[model samples]
Target chain A: MAVSDRSASHLGEAVGLSDEQLIEMYRLVALTRALDERMWVLNRAGRIPFVISGQGHEGAQVAITWPLRKQHDWVAPFYRSIATCLTFGMSPRDILTAQYATANDPSSGGRQMPGHYGSREHNLVSVSSPVATQLLHAIGIALAAKVRGTDQVAMTFMGEGSSNQGDVHEGLNFAAIHKLPFVFVVENNGYAISVPSAKELAVEDVASRAGGYGMPGLVVDGSDVLECYRVATEAVDRARSGGGPTLIEAKVTRLTAHSSDDQQTKYRSEEELASEKARDPLPRFRAQLVDAGILTDHVEQRLGADIKAVVDDATQYAESQPDPDPSTAMRWVYAEEWPSEAPPPWGFGTAGGHAEEH
Target chain B: MPAKTFIEAIREGMADEMRHDGSIIVLGEDVGKKGGVFLATDGLWAEFGDDRVIDTPLTESQIIGTSIGAAINGLRPVAEIQFADFIHPAFNQLVSEAARLRYRSNNGYSCPMVVRAPYGGGVHGALYHSQSVEAFFTHVPGLKVVIPSTPYDAKGLLRSSIRDDDPVLFFEHKKMYRSVRGEVPDGEYAVPLGRAAVTRAGTQLTVIGYGLMAHYALEAAERVADDGISAEVIDLRTLRPLDKESVLDSVRKTGKCLVVYEDNRFGGYGAEVAAIVAEEAFDYLDGPVTRMAGPDVPGVLQPRPRGLVHDQPGEDRRRDPD
Candidate 1:
C-alpha cells in the first residue's frame, strides 16, 4: 500500500480512540506496571539478576503506540519501553521470559541482559546496550520502507540522555533529507541514569532541535494519555502519508529510579519527588476514566486483580522455563551459512538463515 | 583479465557486485563525488545513482551506524571510513552493534556489511592518515578482518567480504592502493575469507605478513634469494579467521617463521599469527618464531621518508633459527 489519501478525519475528535481501544491501552499500561514491579521484587529476592523498570513512562509509551498498526509499523524501542513493547504485541510471558533470561525468550534467547526486547512478528527491531544506535536502525527500516514503496512507518524511542548522542543527530538529519516514513519520540523523563536533562541539552525542550533538521517539532504532555495519543496519532498519520519524520518530545515523569540500581532520592529532592508522584500517570489516568464513567470501581478492582494474576503467572512460568544452554551459546555468533555460490536475487538469504520474499 | 592497481581492483570488485546485486550500497565521507580520498571508490557514483552511492556527512558514527542498520534491513552496505586512523568514532557501531547483531539477535538479524578503510604508512600520511587498525578488531570475535597485499587479492577478498554474511573489516593498505599492480580477473571471482596465499615458494624459512608487509616480504625474499636463503613468503589476506592451514604448512616446510607488520610490535596482529604457529605447529618448528614490526609509538613520531624510518620491519626480514 502507498501513502493513504485519508483526510484529517483519520484523527477523529476527542483523542479518536474507541472505548474498547482505550480500555485495551489502559490494560496494557497496568500490566506493564504490574510486570515491572514484579521484576523489582524478583531482582531484590535474587531470583532475577537485573531489572529496568518502565514505571513512569508507561502513559506516554502506551498512548503513542496505541494508534500504531501493530504488525505493520516497526518499533525500535529503548530499554525503558516495556509498556510500549507490550502495547505493540509482546505478551507478559514473553517479557518475563526475557527478564528471567530463559530459552523461551524470543528477544535474545536468553543471550542478552534483561530489557533488550525484539520480535519480528511485533515488528520491533532488536537493539543493543549502546544508546541512540536504534534510532539509526529505525531510520534504516524507514529507508527500506521508502525504497520498497511500502506505507510502513518506523518509530524509535530514546531517553533525554540519548538525545545528546551523535547517532541521534545523524538519524534525524538523514530521515529529514530522505523524507523517510519515520518518527522520533524523545521520552523526556528528566534524568538519564544520573545525568539530568539540563546537563544533556542547552535547550529547554528536546523538540527544539527539530527545526535544525527541517521537521515539525512537537511537545506533548506525556502524563496525559489522551494528549500523547493525539500528538502521536497526528505524527503517525503524517509519516504514513509521505509527510516525512516528526520529532515528538513527551514530557513524562520518572516515578522510579533509573533502574533497580539507581537512587533518585540522592539527586532529586523530597519536594520534587512528591510533586512528580502527584502527577503519576497511572492513578491520574484511572481517576480520569472513573470520573468519565468509562470505568467503574468494580471494573478497576477486577482489572487490577486480573493484571496481577497475569504478571504473577508470567513470572512463575518464566522462572520455570529452562535457561539457554551454554554449549549452544556460540550458534548465532556468525550466520548459519554464507553464499557458497551466487546469492539470491535479493541477498537476504546470505545472512539470517531465512529466505525472505522480495 | 586485466592488470589493475589495488584501488582499481577494489572499485572493480565493488562495481561488479553492485551490478550483480541491486541491494549493495556504498556510503561514506566524499565516497560519492570525491570517489573517496584514496580514489578507491572512483566512478561508483557516476555508475550508480546518488541513492546507491551515497555521499554521507563526515560523521563516522553515522556512516557505520547507518550501514549496520541498512545491512540488517537487507542492504549489503559497504561503508568506507576514509582512513583507518579515523575509525575510532565508528568503533562502537562496528564492534558492539554490527559484529554482535547476528549473535545478539539469535540470528534473527544479521549485519552483512563491509567497512573498508585505507591503512598503513610509507606515503608520509603521518598520524591521522597512517595506522594499522587490524589489531583492535582482530580481538573482536564476530568481525572478519581482511588486509590484502596485491590487486588480485584485494579485488577477490573484497568481493568475498561484501558477499559474506558476517561483518568484514577490509583494510586496504594506503601504500598499496596506487603503487601495487597485479592481474585481476574481469569476470566475477572471490578469494575466500579465511585462506592465506603462498606468494613465493621457498624451502629454507617461511616469512609471513599481511597488506604492505607481505609485499615488502616478497621484495625482501627476492633480495635474500641471491644469498641462497629461500624464504617462503606467505601473504595472510584475511587477519581474523586466520589461514592457520597455510601458516602451519609453510612453517612445517620451512621449519621457521618471521612475521612482519607495520603495527606496533606489542599486541600487533602479527603477535596473534606468531602465537598460532607456536601453538599449532610448535612440534615442526626448527627455531623460535620472531616478529619484526614497527616500534610501539604513535604515527606522528615515527621517522619519515619511508626507508629512512629506523624501525621499518621490511628491512629486518632475515632468518634467525637460534
Candidate 2:
C-alpha cells in the first residue's frame, strides 16, 4: 500500500506473496532472461533477424503483471514487453515463434519485426513498431471497459524515449479527462535506442510530467520485483475502483544494446555500463530468493537447468517451423472472408488484385 | 419514404443503427453536445446520452487511436475528425494502426471503426477547413475510402461501413451536406462497398468521379446531352476497392474517359482513376484519359468574389476551368 523508494524491500513475503508464487516469479524471470539470451545468439548466427533484449527488465516486467487476470484484463504491450507478455500467458514457444516469424506466429505471420507481441486469446493488443501508440490503445480499451461496466483495468507499456511522443501526451490527457480505468507504465531503462534520459525527458523523472495530465504518477525500482508488484497492484486496483488512470515510471536498466543492429558502447560510457550490472534485476531477484532460504543451491541449479531446457526446446521448435507461406504473403489486408461484394473484373477482390497497393 | 439532405440521411443512418445495436457509439470534438461542427451528429447526445455519444477532447489522434482500440476490443465506435483538413494529425493512427491492424496482426485482430470527416470546399471554409484529402488515404491499402454522392447512397453505405469488419474512412462533402437531397427508403437497405453506379448512361465518353464531383459530372453530362455529346457519368461510391469493372466497362463502351476530383490536380485521386483506365482499358481507349481536378493550390476556394452565392453584385456568371 506504500509507494516505496528505490531501496525498498524486495522480499516476496514482505509483500504478502507465498513461497510458491515467489518461486514461480523467479522461474519466469530466469526463463525470460534465458530466452532473450537465445534470441541474441539466433540473431548473431543468422537464424533470426533481430533481437530486443529484456535482460535487466525481467523483474519489473514480470512482477508488475502478477496481479492481472490472464485473458480477462487487457494489455497493450510494446516491443520490449517479453516478460509482461509471458506473464500475460505468452509461452516461451510463442516468443520464439514471433522471433522467427514462422507460419504459426500469432503476433504476426513473419510480417513485423521481432519483439512485436499480441494475442487476442490472451487479451493482449497488437504491438506495433511505433512507440507510444499502445498508450492510446490502452486508454481506448479502458474506455470500452468503463462503458460496458466490465470492471476491467487496461494497462500499457512504453519506454522513456517513447514518452516524448505526441501520442503519449494525447493518450494521457484523454484518459485523464475521461477518468478511464487505465494504467500507463513507462519502462525507463536509462536510454531509448541511444538517447539517454536527459536528452529524452527535460524533467527529472518521467513521472513528473503526469501532473500536467492530471494523473497520479510515481516512480518504482524496476530491479525490485516485489515493490513493483505492490505498486502496479495498487494502480490497477485504483483503476478498477473508479480512481481513474495512474502513470508509473519503472527505472530499469537495459542490459544490452538497443537491438541487434544498435551498439550502445558507441555512446554509453564504461562506468554507466558497469553501473547497470549492479542494477540487473534477474541476479538481484535470484540472490534475494536465496538469502531468504526460499531457494538453495540445488533448487537454483534445477531452476537454471529447467529454463535452459525450455529455451532450447523453444528455439528448436521455432527453427524447424515453416516460414510464412510465400504464396499467401498478402493476406488479411481487409479482414479475410468478410464476404466481398463479388469483386469486379481484373480479379479485384482476389489476393493479388486487392493488394495492388499492399 | 421521404427526401432528406445528405447530412440528415447520415444522421438517420447512425441513429437507426445505434437504435438497432447498442454497441455503436459516436466520439469526437463537438460530436455530442454541440452535435458536431456541421451538425452531422445533431441530436445524438440527447438520444444516446453521454455514454453512447461521447464528446472527446480536441485531439484527432486520441479520437481515432481510442476508436481503434475500442473497435478491436468490443464496441463499434464511430470517431469523427471535425474536418478533413484536421485529419492529418491522426493519419498515423488510421494508416499505421487501423489500416494495418488486421494485416500486421495477420488477421489476429481487425479495427471495425468508422472515421467520418466532412471534406471538400464550398461553404467558404477557407484554408484549414476547405481541404480535400481523400487521395491521401485512398492510396493506402487495407482501408476503405467512401464518398457518397446522394442521400440514398449515404444511408446505405453508412450501414455497410458500420457492419463491415474493417476500418472505413467516410468522407462527406461539406458542399453537398445540405445542398444534395434524394429519397431514402424507410426500411432497411445497405449498399455494399467496392461498387460504383452509372448515374447517366451514354456512349460518347465516360465521366468518372465521386462525392460532389459525381453530382456535377451528372449535371455536366445532362447539359452536354443537349449539345449532342453523349456522356456517361460513373459515381465511384467507394474509392479504394474502386469499382474497376464499372469504370472499365464504361470506358470500353465509350472510347474516351475523363476523371474529375476536387483535390489537387498534381496528385489528385482522379489521377489514380486515370492511371487505372490507362493500365487496363488501354486498348479500348480511343484517346488518352484526362483528369479535371482542382489546380495545384494549397486549398480549394469558391473562386474570386467569395460571397457571391448565385448571381451577386459584379460577379461573372460564366464558369471556367481554373
Highest DockQ model number:
2
lDDT of 1 by residue, B174-249 (tens): 7777766799989878888777889899998999988888877988899899999999999988887776767888
In TM-score terms, candidate 2 sits at: 0.94
Worst 10 residues of 2 chain B by lDDT: B313-322
User: Which predicted model would earn the best lDDT?
Assistant: 2
Native contacts matched by each model: 0.54, 0.69
> What tens-digit string does per-residue lDDT give for candidate 1 at A201-318?
8999999999999999999989888899989999999999999999999999988888888887899989998888876788888777766655666677778888988988998899
Instruction: Name model 1 segments beyond 4 Å from true.
Output: A1-12, A297-302, A338-358, B300-303, B308-322
Best by TM-score: 2
Q: Which segments of candidate 2 are over 4 A away from where they belong? A: A1-10, A338-358, B302-322
Residue-wise C-alpha lDDT for candidate 2, range A1-358, written one tens digit per residue: 1111223234654787876778788899989988999999899999998998888888999998888888999999999999999999999999999999999998988888899999988989999987788888888899999888899899998888999999998999999988899999989997878888888777979999999999999999999998899999999889999999999999999989999999889999999899879999988888888887776677778787888889999999999999987867767888655333333332444453443333
Candidate 2, DockQ score (0 to 1): 0.61
**Cα lDDT tens digits for candidate 2, B163-199:** 8888999999887787777999988899988788999
Candidate 2 chain A weakest ten by summed lDDT: A1-10
